[model samples]
Target: MTDPITIQWTPKTGLPRRLTFEPLEKGYRRIEREWNGSEWRHCGSEHTTDLTLHPPEDPPTLEELISQIHGTWDHPNPAVLTFTNEDTVAEINGQLRYRSPTQDGWYAVTKTDLESHLRTAGYPTIHRLSETPYNRADFTADSIPRQ
Candidate 1:
């Protein structure tokens, strides 16, 4: 049996779904799953012999990305960033921090800095989910888990 090909997507509900194509005897079995916080739950499945998968569509919009930004994975004190209706305002660790320039490797970042820089900045060498993976969070910095 050949290895399965898995595809992932995040919908309007903010929950992530995964579609896996597993090679079968004369066809492929497609398994659909949704992420329920800590695990992936099966939603549905099907079998197809003739199926052509297409490339994924456009990336998530800035608004979508911003909305997904929440609790920090490696934060010591379980920091969370809550965005208000005002674009320039955000509460970090329950303290309101206004729009401002955040230096590299800093823990606190303003909403403006996140939208303008963090989104496009180079990813740290670390896996962003695992410790001792590769890069150090202290030098590069950790990120919220989305993918």
Candidate 2:
């Protein structure tokens, strides 16, 4: 069976709405939800015994994933903090010193930190994707620190 897909769009007269198609054992289920300015509210759902739907024949390549990520334009601008060996902490131009528990006044918050928090809060998956192009070495521990 194919993975669930959700398509979102905003109507000309109403709030934004999204339709999600989830694959089930018997068939598929379609769930409709609308954004009510605060949260998504379920509108309705329908099930059909359609098992002909399938995923793409070929899996998406790494290049395709990277290209799709760069094509998107709605990413948030996160605040980056830089940590020094001393107690003094300051925000970088854009935007850790790991000490004892008591000495830990402020440490740099990495992307891994935010992703871990979201996952712990019941989020399904958190991807460590970069806004700009990057290589494998960019994620290595010995790589240059991002500014």
Candidate 3:
């Protein structure tokens, strides 16, 4: 017997529908379900050996968040830049400190300032070492479980 394949389906309108193609003795059986607003309701189960299948791509391993690091002038309020996609995620957080209390907003932060901030934050400010994960999947599903 051929290994059965589960095909991902996209609806022509509205939300997508879930369907699978299971191999049968004579042909293939297409089992489909419908979304009734709240839960998935059974729609149809039929032999669909003639129909073509278009499977959707697998979901991404990680949700990548990206953030642009920028400096603050007044710095009474600071923001972090972050982005997340289905595939990957990245974040860039920053801190702004003046050389002296007298230093005005006119002074813009430089690489030197970023290093100092990292030092104060207990990171390797001089080497600018990064401990970002090599594999993001470990952070996504392998770590925690639902309570």
lDDT winner: 1
Clash pairs for candidate 2: 80-95
What are the root-mean-square deviations of the candidates from the true structure over C-alphas?
Answer: 16.2, 17.1, 19.9
What are the runs in model 1 whose C-alpha is more than 4 Å off?
A: 54-147
Candidate 1 lDDT over residue span 1-147, tens digit each:
779999999998679999999999999999999999999999999776655666467545545543443434345432223222211223344332322134233244444555665434421121122222122233234532222
Ten contiguous residues with the weakest lDDT in model 3? 81-90
TM-score of 2: 0.33
lDDT of each: 0.50, 0.45, 0.38
RMSD of 3: 19.9
lDDT for each residue of candidate 3 in 1-147, tens digit (9 for 90 to 100): 577766555677866577777788878888887676797777789775544455566422221101222332124322221111111112223322222222222123434543454434322211110222122222223222212
- What's model 1's TM-score? 0.35
Best candidate, TM-score: 1
| TM-scores for every candidate against the unseen true structure | 0.35, 0.33, 0.27
CA error at residue 43 for candidate 1, angstroms: 0.5
